[model samples]
Target chain A: MSQDQKRDAIIEAALKRFAHFGVAKTTMSEIGADLAISKASLYYYFPDKINLYAAVLLHIIHEAEQAYGPLVDQEPDPFKAMDALLKHRTEFIIKYYNVISFIRSKHDIPEELKPVFGSVHASELSRMRKMVEKGVASGRFRVADVADMGSLLFECLEGLRMMYLEQASSFFPTPEQFHNLLKREQQLSQIFFNGLTV
Target chain B: MSQDQKRDAIIEAALKRFAHFGVAKTTMSEIGADLAISKASLYYYFPDKINLYAAVLLHIIHEAEQAYGPLVDQEPDPFKAMDALLKHRTEFIIKYYNVISFIRSKHDIPEELKPVFGSVHASELSRMRKMVEKGVASGRFRVADVADMGSLLFECLEGLRMMYLEQASSFFPTPEQFHNLLKREQQLSQIFFNGLTV
Candidate 1:
């Protein structure tokens, strides 16, 4: 196998393990055993556990960006791009919430991984901001401030996702949980549309 | 001091300790020492660390109810009461987010504490639902599904609070820090008013 291919395989395996077992419990040896590689061979690619862990993180961030990277070409109507972006983000959150959580939770990410994540998520943030700003420029969005309005809209969705994660216990009182959540999402969307429509 | 007074004192100390230091690092001996009571005396009040921990949790729940409990009163024209309730909840979250986290992270809280938190939060939930229902009935709220509307509203606020708490590294974006939050609150209120208005 090619060296980078083998490394990427290990990174993917380690991410799945980290997602299920969390960082503390997932052993480097276990990651190697899963790949049918010896611990020594794994160490040859990545120097230590933290290095391997960061590789897993960078891999996910890379994958997430590939899945829903920021808008660059969707300029004629940014809202269309935004609509697609929101849907893309929602799907990513649902499928990779663990990866999302891992990214969200820590400040200890290695410097090597930060540029990748910062560039991707930060670009996505600005891309969405620009889309809102564009709508405002064209007399579409009517909010008092474009950035505040955009942040509020994004946080509303991210907040719902965070609540869903935190209230995974039965304590989450929503009836027909999916229906209830979707209804909430629509309501927030409706409110935004109402407040922001020009 | 009377037995109840001393017991309540101990519970209060334990909760403060738990809130800041978390459950793992919090020691029974430390709680006892904080109260200036002997370990034997502490045991007399509660059988084990778990029991004392539960007692501490229940006390906080009781305080939470005391702090935000009255908004659920059955009365005509409860909008004022609800506004007060939401404001109280906002303050509660701001001041006690850590305490909430402490209680929330526990998997097996004492039986006594469970109902205290569940019933109180459930009552608050019902009150939120009730406020929307009452608003709708009185033609003061939007004509949407009252419960879903209420969940959406709370989820937005809750989501913001949780995000602020979870992503402490990232600051909320703007002059609307407090204003924009209040703005969203106002927007939700406006929607409710529109939905319920004749």
Candidate 2:
């Protein structure tokens, strides 16, 4: 394989190991063994485990951003666009449950990952801003403070998304529980959207 | 002191110790010592540590119910009543942060405390129902499902209240963080209340 292809192969193998065993438990040698690469060869591509972990996270974030960007940017109806975005977010969170949990295990995000995470946050907020601005322009939303409204709506939806995670007996929610969460989100958002109407 | 008054004193003493040290660490002997009573005397009023813990929790719950019951029932304006109730709730949660954290440590609430907790839940939901029903009757609010809307609004406010607790670096919020939480609640509620209006 070419150098770039080898690096991609290593990242793909590391992602599964990191996701399953967590960062602390998963060793670099195991990751190398999974890819049939020598430890020295793995070290050539990434200097350390933290760097490999970052690569895996970046891979996940890039995939999600690619999926989310078009959904938020392209939808004609602002409310529909937001609904779609939130729905996709719910899936993304669940798909990356272990990875997210590992990141959240610490009180703060790691220094190395902060910039990437911050950029993701900034872009999400901007997308939210765009959708609300669209709504206001269309005369569909009568918002007093567009920025505050957009973020408050985001917070409210985020809270709904986290409800199951905090309250459930299991580490992850059952399918039925996930359905209930989305149902509650829909119900709450209907009232919230109505409040924003002209 | 009379028997009932002495029982009350013991509960009062236990509350402070339990709130500060948690139920597991706060011994029955220490609680009795706080009140200048013998361990036998303390057990005369309550059977064991669990029983005393229950009594202490009941005492706190009763005090909160008394404080909250009037605010929800007597306020003429539904939105104002809810606002007042939520503000009071934020204070209550902060004050009992440790106690509540202890309760949440368990996957399910202890079987012994379930009835009392259930009653409190039932009353809170009923009060919410009453406030929305009053709004609907007065034509101040427009709601399709009164029961569902009241609970949904309650959940939304609850989510906002928990925002600081879940995100804070410290176990309990600092004063400034507390202020910000209430501020965000007011902002979010304004939009939510508007959605419910005629």
lDDT top scorer: 2
TM-score of each: 0.61, 0.78
> Whose DockQ is greatest here?
2
Write candidate 1's Cα lDDT for A28-136 as tens digits: 8899999999988999999887778666766765676676564533554654655555556556555555444444333345666666656665665566577667677
Q: Worst ten-residue run, lDDT, model 1 chain A?
A: A170-179
Interface RMSD of predicted model 1: 3.2
TM-score top scorer? 2
Model-by-model DockQ, in order: 0.32, 0.52
lDDT of 2 by residue, B1-198 (tens): 999999999999988987798777888889888999988899999988777777887788789879876867788787787788778877876787666556642234677777766677677767778878878987988888999877876677667655556666445566567778888888777777787888
Off by over 4 Å in 2: A1-4, A14-34, A43-54, A91-122, B1-3, B15-34, B44-54, B91-123
lDDT of 2 at A181: 85
Instruction: Categorize the docking of model 1.
Output: acceptable
Scanning candidate 2 chain B in windows of ten residues, the lowest lDDT window is B100-109
Question: TM-score of chain A, model 2?
Answer: 0.79
List the lowest-lDDT window of 10 residues for candidate 1 chain B.
B168-177
lDDT of 1 by residue, B1-198 (tens): 999899888888888887788766888899998978899998999888777766665676667667667544555464565666656655655454454444433244456567665766566567667776777777655555678766666677667655554453443233234444555655545544443455
